[model samples]
Target chain A: TQLLEQSPQFLSIQEGENLTVYCNSSSVFSSLQWYRQEPGEGPVLLVTVVTGGEVKKLKRLTFQFGDARKDSSLHITAAQTGDTGLYLCAGADSNYQLIWGAGTKLIIKP
Target chain B: GAGVSQSPSNKVTEKGKDVELRCDPISGHTALYWYRQSLGQGLEFLIYFQGNSAPDKSGLPSDRFSAERTGGSVSTLTIQRTQQEDSAVYLCASSLFFMQGILSVGELFFGEGSRLTVL
Candidate 1:
């Protein structure tokens, strides 16, 4: 079983639409991170939520960590075509190794 | 600052051949990790190196896979007797020592990944 499960393996929406992606797990994590990857490039860190119930905003994107530290969410508002990419969530296990989700491919078409 | 970098962006090798992929982590970073991403699949952890200590090789998929970090800077991941199933993009990441499992909160600086195809 995947330690981290991501919902909506794929997403397609028109420009300006808003959406949310989820990452869930029954295990608690020390911290959770979100990344965005474009074709032909490596993933880049978008945000990191450390504390339980913590929320972070990066311009048009918002990230929230579950109060129990077992889940997280990524929301985009007024999405633009540039927002299209693969969104990945990862958690740091107690061993310091990162457990990754399968990633959600988000396509914002104009 | 320069981010992580890998060599031979793309490679194609015959099945049963051996292949070595290299990674150059960011300067001053003491933690390095290797992972593989097969087509349409999630990233799978392979190995990790921290300072002069022994590496964590628990994630290696088989006995044919091995990795070593020299001088705590550059690392090489070797897959012996490569098989078709080994075709995938290999990614490398680096972070500061203190960021191992704490302060930096798992913020990884990733290289542009090496794509290997076993024919």
Candidate 2:
């Protein structure tokens, strides 16, 4: 069974649009992380949130961790073509074991 | 190298053949994990190794799948009698510190992954 689940398995939007991808789970996590991956390369870390109800912003991209630490969301504003790739979320269990989400494949059409 | 390394990057083999995939984590990383991904699918946990403790082999799909981390540095995953269903991209990741308790929720550094295609 998948411990963490992601929504909108595939997304296609025009440049300058806004979109939100969500990751949810029933189990609370000690830490949550977001990663972006391009073809032919490994996923790269975008941010890590350790506290519930915490939000982090990276330029036009905003990430929020749910108050109960059981969910997270990534919102991208004024999406650019460069943002086209796969967005993945991972949660760490008490034992430091990471449970990964299925991922959201985002495409920004110019 | 500065990042985790994996090879051979791509492998194509026939059924019943055996194959080996290798991973070299960044220097000083104590935790290593192996995951498999099908086309456009989520990662599937394979195995995990942390420091000196025995590996967590619960994730291994079957007896034909096995892995080893030698000298607490390099790792190798071996698949015997490969089947077409075994085709997937095998990913390796390492964290600098996971033994320090909840305080240090080490972020994983990943390799590009080795793509295996069993015919």
Candidate 3:
């Protein structure tokens, strides 16, 4: 019953590599959000996309919302060791209830 | 508090015991959500409280798990007869919601989480 499907549930890469994680769903969402979490800490919001086909960039990280609003992607360029952590995506339904995706655990090797 | 606050950052209890976890959301944030996370896994929704409306408890795993948000502010998650399977980090998050549901699709501030370990 997981409405949001995130790909590459686990990823391990060396520093300086580029990577992309995806979150897809069959249902359209009003808004999509991405978060990054470190061990023993809460997930912190990275970006939120509302308008369909909108693209947002945060530093070296790029976030894109699907034109249909049913999917999203997060891309990181030149990954750093500091980028290692769990990446999560959440989509807000029409009722404003958020459906979370299975997280992607990323490990950046130095 | 400036951010969401959760009590008992870590808790360890024997099986079949009862436990309570508290959450204090940012003042004025009326939308509160509780989630559980197992080691490196995705979050499991527990419950959510919006304004004065009845909470959505559809995600509660069992009758042993219950939560209450009082006066649209603080919240408490109680687990009666805790089991080892209940061990996980309980996360509390708060968001600001306006008149419409669309406005509710905003940022969610989260607490550090309360880690519960049942033997």
Which candidate tops lDDT? 3
Estimate the TM-score for candidate 3: 0.97
Give the range where candidate 3 chain A is weakest over 10 consecutive residues by summed lDDT. Answer: A1-10
| Candidate 2 colliding pairs | none
What TM-score against the true chain A does chain A of each candidate get? Answer: 0.97, 0.98, 0.98
For residues A1-110, could you state the per-residue lDDT of candidate 2 as single tens digits? 43899999999999999999999999999999999988877888999998999999999999999999999999999999999998999998987778999999999999
DockQ in order: 0.67, 0.72, 0.81
State the lDDT of candidate 1 residue by residue for A52-71, as single tens digits.
99999999999999999999
Off by over 4 Å in 1: B99-104
Proportion of native contacts kept per candidate: 0.65, 0.62, 0.76
Q: What C-alpha lDDT values do all the predictions have?
A: 0.91, 0.93, 0.94
How far does residue A59 in candidate 1 sit from its true spot (Å)? 0.7
| TM-score, chain B, each candidate | 0.92, 0.95, 0.95
Give a tens-digit lDDT track for model 3, residues B71-106: 889999999999999999999999988866336576
lDDT of 1 by residue, B1-119 (tens): 48898987999999999999999999998899999998756788899898898999989999999999999899999999999999999999998758444455447999999999999
Poorly placed runs, candidate 2 (over 4 Å): B98-103
- Candidate 2 displacement at residue A71 in angstroms: 0.5
